[model samples]
Target: MNRAFNRKRDKTWMHTPEALAKHYIPYNAKFLGNTEVEAPKGTEVVEDAVRKLKFQRHIKKSEGQKVPKVELQISIYGVKILDPKTKDVHHNCQLHRISFCADDKTDKRIFTFICKDSESNKHLCYVFDSEKCAEEITLTIGQAFDLAYKKFLESGGKDVETRKQIGTLQRRIQELETENSELKKQLQDFEEQLMMVHGSPAGSISIQTQSTDVFDMVPFSPVTPLVPTQANNASPPPPPTTLPPDISKDLFGAEPFDPFTCASADFPPDIQSKLDEMQEGFKMGLTLEGTIFSLDPLDERC
Candidate 1:
């Protein structure tokens, strides 16, 4: 029974949640004194003897003051003073608000620092006595401050890099937008030119596709000749007469020939006989076959 109970207890303990680890340093120090001091506004004022005078005056004021035992807690965020017995907070000064911290050269057990009061808006000097651990306390505070500053720089660097990337992306987006606008303008101009050439909008233009086959392109229709009608009774035109060979040179020349008036003695026998037959045919109002017709007017024809 005892062995079973022990096993169960061990299992229960193992299953229980563990606490998260906390990081901080605590030192026992005697609060020597605190005094309000003039805030340094610039490097010149900081380097002047006025700060030294204030420091000396604060030290003098702390000479007879009662020293109270307090706990100085240091962390990456800030420093705090707590009552050792009741665990009550006395003062809390954030790391960023602390302006200065230094150890006394004459006494290794004494250290002093100045911080801005959040509520009073004043600079206050605090002096502490930590016996042999004075240097260790100051060193711990310095280390915490260093770590915090390094962390701040790391975060700030990431933010700066992110901003640079965002800026580059923004600039690239702007360039692409500008290029897009130019392309749109060019497209509009090209469309306008197309409209001017085609006498219509580009979208409204149509393509006339020609048939590939010759037979499909032309319509096949039977042609019909017109029949004669009584209302339009007109005789068909006579066939055109044939012109004699060399007629332009012989009949219409500067010196024309008069066949009938010409003497038979001036022509060959064959030509004289042909001319006699043509003149007789013209006077009888008859057309002779295979005979050249005279160009004279006829009164009637059979």
Candidate 2:
């Protein structure tokens, strides 16, 4: 017994779950815990990258003193005053854009609080990494406009119904303008006809009344009764006449018929026969017995 039973060999076990959670795992662990390590501290330098985006410019600052930098610009109106191509010199559209100070401190740089176009007049904020891109990130004005607009529309312009309504209104406006132009052309033609009928230049007419139709000059007249003693009256009057069919039928119905309709008589006979053959083939296949039969296809079946 050299150690006299070694003092009964003291043994101790410690269960420190919280300490493990706070120290062992990085979930709540600090690298230097209240002690500054001898490492380079990150310096957050704001790098300025100027982007000449499409549409218009929106200064982030207010009109008064010390205007804040505008984070984004919305291209509510895009007027193409000049273009490389001469054909489309002046075309306008609705576009938008967003600009912000970038932080390229690391290879995996990130954009912080990216202010983008919002609804009618709002701004959106979010964070996105410049890395992890499946596609190349080439900066273009159009692309920037689209990005901001898309994000803004997703946020502020979330009302799909409203967008649909706006689209409908725009279409209606275009239709009205087209109709107005047609009407103006028709008016000019009528005026020319009037000038020819009057045997004078159209300019001779007063400017105020030039728009009026020449037919308007013909006033309504009452039927005058003829005396029975007239020599022509000796012949018996013709039988009562029937009304003519609507003369104005489809006077302006030049609009093309739906191309999808194959049932109309105007359809091509060859195409109609092919279609009938297809239908017959389909019908025969549906039946239990696969029997093929042919029917006399009408000339107007198409």
Candidate 3:
């Protein structure tokens, strides 16, 4: 368990000084811009976007060379010019052209840095007074500028990606709105068809609708009958009779009937007796005063 705990990785390893150099280079610079002016100087530049070039001229207490000035500002995109005494900034953001060469022109050892002026358009030169380390100072400044410019370009790429996401969302919203309209149209068509059915001849019952009816639907509803439409046009039924021949075919406008068998069509004696007794009660001024009786047609109900 102890070994496993000891093997935990360092999450902050990337923030270490050595690891940080991959994204940024931190270098202290010296100023030797004027070869004729002799002064003891301590110089360093530090910042997030643009590094300030600070110069503290070393001289006797009575000398004018003992001045603290911050005049040049450097970043990845371009350089800025400033007032040395007042420290006021000047010029556009893209203000300077920077390149380097050896002071000896070919020595490659005694390095010199050069930058073009924004207003003058002429080049200014500088070199660290230290004989052995001037080359290191010149090379470090060049690399720092490169990294800053790369970051600026990456920021622009993020803006383009955000615009693309916005455009995609707008198109999706339009599609949803169009689909909602089509659904509303389909619902309207279904309501109209329902209204037509209620007003047809099949639905014979009259329904009174109110002005405040919800969704324009019918106010009253009636149940439909199970009988077919042909029943309405049929003739009235015939009176009950005790004849052998079937007379129903004429009453209902049907074809004349033929006998089912070559014999007399008659009820059983017991059935006929019950039917006659029921009929005699009608003569006694009663609609019916008899026992139960039933009669079925040969093929269908009467």
lDDT of each structure?
Answer: 0.51, 0.27, 0.34
Models 1 onward score TM values of 0.39, 0.19, 0.25
Candidates sorted by lDDT, best first: 1, 3, 2
lDDT of 2 at 101: 21
User: How far in Å is the alpha carbon of 72 misplaced in model 2?
Assistant: 34
Task: Tell me how many residue pairs clash in candidate 1.
Answer: 0
* Candidate 1 ranges with C-alpha deviation above 4 Å: 1-22, 40-65, 155-302
Candidate 3, which segments miss by more than 4 Å at Cα?
A: 1-30, 34-96, 101-109, 155-302
In model 3, the Cα lDDT at residue 130 comes to 37
How far residue 160's Cα lies from its native spot in candidate 1, in Å, is 8.4
Arranged by TM-score with the best first, the candidates are 1, 3, 2
Per-residue CA lDDT of model 1 for 1-302, tens digit only, reads 23212322243321112110135677898876576667522223223323454466577667964557899888766788999999899999765556555555566777766666878868777778777887566555545544444454454422433444454665675565566556656666765665455433433333333333454432333652122111123343332233333422322243333332432224445654444433332222211111111223233111
Task: Kindly indicate the candidate among 1 and 3 with the higher TM-score.
Answer: 1
lDDT by residue (237-281, candidate 2, tens digit) is 332233332322222434323323432233255654434433332
Relative to the unseen true structure, what is the Cα RMSD of model 3?
43.0
